[model samples]
Target: MNSVFIRKALLLSAVLFSSVVLSQTQDEVKKENPTVDFALEGRIGVAVGDKAVGINVGGPSLKLKLNGFKIGVGAFPSLLVLDGDAAPRLSVSPIIEYKKWMLITPYYGYDAEKKMIWTFGIGYKFK
Candidate 1:
């Protein structure tokens, strides 16, 4: 039973990795798969400092973005560390993203607990 859970977890990890790697950017998706109405995206970025929250600038942070919207949770505390702090700040944000014509997508969201913040980034999305 324990081995079954381990196998499932490992398989899930592989799927996520494959999605992130095989996914095409916005342009490609719009050009080839226009029929695809929504997408599931995985976001990976550096630990940019938050002025309002005073978070120590350090490593990378990963989050799941859905349908290009700002309604996702941070997927941190993985096997690899994404921040310098020992205890990760497991915060959730409900962001409102503005996807421009270009590849970049600018977002304005609050950390709810910390404060308001502005984030501009593009991520890999797949079906």
Candidate 2:
């Protein structure tokens, strides 16, 4: 299964398990509902490797919360003005978040030379 599907399955399992473990009676179980969270933020980071040093730029990021689950999308661009000889770079990341503001984001990127790229990052929400 794709990452998205796997994440959804895990979230479903977690909610079901929590309901079972926390429920003391039928009434309490029926009252439990997942809460949603929403946020707008910016991210800054860099891509570094041998031969060239790349700078990271800050970009808009979004998060949507449902129950204890969150789904998010972010886009980042590298201006390349500092490193003209380096590879071209652009990136997009779709992410999933869980309880306590923990986030997992797997990213795809491209260089100016059209090489395959990948990245993974973990984040936390403070607000």
Candidate 3:
């Protein structure tokens, strides 16, 4: 209820504040040092199921952002909580990211025993 709203507000505030701090520091660094070519990005999402609420946090994924095109790799894993029961899974994939307002990477995961699965996500580049 109110607590969920409060928590979301706090998380959003923290992200914005951090982004400002990072942006300022990065700007200063560029004036003093050569630009770096690497960045890390990730996604967090809430997954809904028939009887459960789940959470996901994936990637501090590494990428090479050169001339506005990025190529990278990352993994996604999630925990599902169902009426006190839990299930978990992990999938790894290579990703290709493009800059369009923000960075979006579309991935197709291929595990040795599993079929190829496709996923799409956005990334924030730091540095």
* Model 3 misplaced regions, further than 4 Å: 1-42, 45-56, 79-86, 98-117, 120-127
Error of 1 at 81 (Å): 9.2
Quote model 1's TM-score.
0.24
- Judge candidate 3 at residue 86 and give its lDDT: 69
Candidate rank order under lDDT: 2, 3, 1
Each model's lDDT comes to 0.33, 0.47, 0.45
C-alpha lDDT of residue 120 in model 1: 25
Cα displacement (angstroms), candidate 2, residue 3, comes to 14
Number of the top candidate by lDDT? Answer: 2
- Of 2 and 3, which scores higher on lDDT? 2
Provide the lDDT at 53 for model 2.
Answer: 36
Better of 2 and 3 by TM-score: 2
Ranking by TM-score: 2, 3, 1
Encode model 1's per-residue lDDT on 1-127: one tens digit a residue: 1445445544554454445545636554236657656754443332222332122221233435567543433332211122333333433322222242111212224443644443222333223
Cα lDDT of candidate 3 equals 0.45
Per-residue lDDT of 1-127 in model 2, one digit per residue for the tens? 1456446544654565455434534243333465865665544444323223344444466879888676777665653322346444555656555543333333344455665444433443433
List all candidate RMSDs to the true structure. Answer: 15.2, 11.4, 10.3
